[model samples]
Target: DFTLEELKSLRVKQRYSFRDQQYNGKFSIITFEEFISIALDAPRVVGIYPEIKNPVFINQRVKWSNGKKFEDIFVETLKKYGYEGSYLSKKWLKQPAFIQSFAPTSLTYISNQTDLPKIFLIDDTTIPTQDTNQSFWEITSDHYLDYIKEYVVGIGPWKDNLVTASNNYLQTPTDLVARAHAHNFQVHPYTFRNENQFLHFNFSEDPYNEYDYWIKKIGVDGLFTDFTGSLHRYQEWTSPFLSSEKDAYNLLDKIVAMIFKVQAHLVLFFT
Candidate 1:
């Protein structure tokens, strides 16, 4: 399966319209399992954000034996390949990840089998949920949020849901963020990209500004980005984890600057 020919065509292109069209001819479609393997093979702890995308369509198209649902196979595959653990456990950090879906039933179904943390994704108000066909208004109700809070560690809602847009300008931020935070639920807005068209004018077309708004103003735990490497770099620059080498380097730099200042003062005094 590890053929040079296949790897050569392994570039990734935009999966949507209004994105950079330059790389459309270069990239190949990748699977969730392959993505997991890539993360697992990384030198340090690499996190993965895998959504159970379009389960209704995938289940309708794909088949299995012994009456196994796609959910069954999917959870089994992850567990089989060593992805079993609760949220933020030692085992989970070894393969840091979150399983997300719009269908609440799917989350409940997998709950019986695995303790891995799950996130229920919310779309716009008019769209019906995938499994139960509940409208977004109903699913997003306070009662429902309180109910699902037990099953899910977080909610991944559309970014617009966080802040409404009125005539292409941002309105007052919604209480949804505050309510969700009250219940100790993490809010991770979806599908942030790095294009002028994707960003609103409020952020000055800088992705970091958008990140600052979401992380500081709105207060989300994580973000779902199209460019994982860019998010990694942004997080490292702004809110870097205190690794030993980083700490040592920072300390050394501070000491060296202090020594230079001290030497300058001594030379002035002696002269």
Candidate 2:
């Protein structure tokens, strides 16, 4: 079995056709510490959403000292980066983060290690869970959400499953979002891209329209977009940041209107 250091020596590449491949082989596989450092060093309060991808396979292949499993090392790395707190807590809001995984068992295993929010990723309806071997139907059921909600704050489902598509045209959305909301669980859909090839016909090949549809119509709590800047801009333009500058502008406008009214009243009184 290859060690972690050996794995880091290998170059990272794009495995999917839809993703950008221009930088393939330019970057080596980064360690968890390196990845965490990138997020922590960002100028803004950027949140890290690292996935414990393919836990079963990772555990079978990778070995650690003290017989630590993959989940153990994963949580340990986050703890080292001070990523421990329940959702929306002061510590979490300061350095927001979410641990995601397709394998339910991996999430369950790490539940006690960190109180950080976890997102259970749901695959296609035909696929089964990587670790538990549970069918998509079984895992997405109301009963399952009830059980899993204890461990996870939200779900990250394949976007198409939430709104089924045929021939690249979106069909009626399923009740997954509503059902998840009913369970007090946030639904964050995945893999929103800006490319025309990825956009549906209903959106007229507009990424903004897709964002509007998902954020406004679908009422999703969060989105997993490939272009974070696109999502950020969309949110900023649609929902302006409620900063002190904005509040000051609003107060200034109110004061100007009040002064105008007083001036008009004085003009009438003088006349």
Candidate 3:
């Protein structure tokens, strides 16, 4: 197990074959605090979505003082950043954050520490839960959703799991989103990208189209896209921002039109 300093010394590289490798090793692994700081410093309000990644293995390898587990460290870092509040509360909306993890036990343990919304990530259907040794089918079952919903506000499933695809083409869509909504839980699927290889054939190689399909058609609560700018642009275009300036201009136009009509009425009455 590498200490935090040792881990920082290592450079990060692209893991996916489809991803650009030119910038490999150009970036270093960042501490959780650094990640939080980056979000806090953004020009606009930016929410942080951090994962308690691989808690089982990390706890097994990393040694901590006072016998604290990885989840403890993760949550402590969040609290240090002033990320406390229940989901959508006034405090939460100002500094939004969501704690995500694939490990159920870790989520449950940390739930007591912080009330920040948590998302239970669902892997591919073939995979099983790392901590509970439960299959995807078992976890996605309605009975399980009922129980897990108590801990998590939502589930982040693989995009493919929501819609069956074969030969890079989308097939029938699943009822997972409907089921999730029925349980009063949000569904935020992950890893959307602009790359052609990553795009399904049905989307015709356009990331915007993919976003439209998910946001408009599938009706997901949120997305985990690699191209945040692309998603932001799409959302802005589809639901254009009504700025205060625009609202003022619209009001001014209505006032001018009303004055013109009233003036015309006075002229007609005199004639």
Candidate 4:
């Protein structure tokens, strides 16, 4: 394996053939500190959602002179960058962040170190938990949700797991979102994309339809989308604020038309 310095020398490339490839070698890999800086420097209040991926594997291969676990290092970096506070707290709204991980043990350990909201990531049904070795069914059970609710503010599950599909057609959605809501936990499903392959047939190959089903029908708290622009457009098209703004503009146009008609009548009368 290459060191961080060696890794930075490599350029980024698109994984899928359908996606844009023009900028494949345009950018190099960025360090975690650089990632944090990008978020901090954004004009708007953009929240950072960093994942503690493969903690079991990372902890085994990586070592520190200070004798800290992978989770400790991760939390220290966040704290160092002033990413502390519960969900929607004043400090959080100023520089919001969510610490996510697939390993339950890592999340639990980090809870003692920082108050930043955490999300428990769920994998495919067939995959077992990397740390606890718990089956998907076991971890998603109401009993497990009850236990995990104390540590994490939400769960980020694989979208297909929440609503299964066969032959690319969507089936009935599971009650995971409802159950999560019942436990006062937010549910944010993952990796929404605009590409046809990533979309289910029920959406008629339209990303907006998929967004409608998930946002309106499924009632998820939020979505983790690959194409942020498409998601932003979808939200704007469906936003109540946009509707109200349109109504205000329409009212102003009608008033201006009435004024012009009245002035024309006055001119004719005076002439």
Q: TM-score: which candidate is best?
A: 4
Model 2 Cα shift for residue 69 (angstroms): 0.8
Q: Candidate 3: what lDDT? A: 0.91
Question: For this target, which candidate reaches the highest lDDT against the unseen true structure?
Answer: 4
lDDT of 3 by residue, 103-179 (tens): 99998998899999999999999999999999999999999999998899999999999998999999989999999
Number of backbone collisions per candidate: 1, 0, 0, 0
lDDT of 3 at 107: 88
Where model 3 places Cα greater than 4 Å from the true spot, the runs are 16-22, 240-271
RMSD of each: 5.5, 5.8, 5.6, 3.8
Q: In model 4, which regions exceed 4 Å deviation?
A: 245-271
TM-score of 4: 0.90
Model 4, CA-based lDDT:
0.93
How far residue 178's Cα lies from its native spot in candidate 2, in Å, is: 0.3
Candidate 2: C-alpha RMSD after superposition: 5.8
lDDT agreement with native, every candidate = 0.83, 0.92, 0.91, 0.93
Residue range 1-271, candidate 2, lDDT tens digits? 6778888789988887777899899988877788888988999898899999998998998788999999998888888888978999999998899999999999999998899999999999999998899999999999999999999999999999999999999999999999999999989999999999889999998899999999999999999998999998887778755555678899999999999999999999999
Better by lDDT, candidate 3 or 1: 3
CA lDDT of 254 in candidate 1? 99
C-alpha-based local distance difference test score of model 2: 0.92
lDDT, candidate 1, residue 36? 77
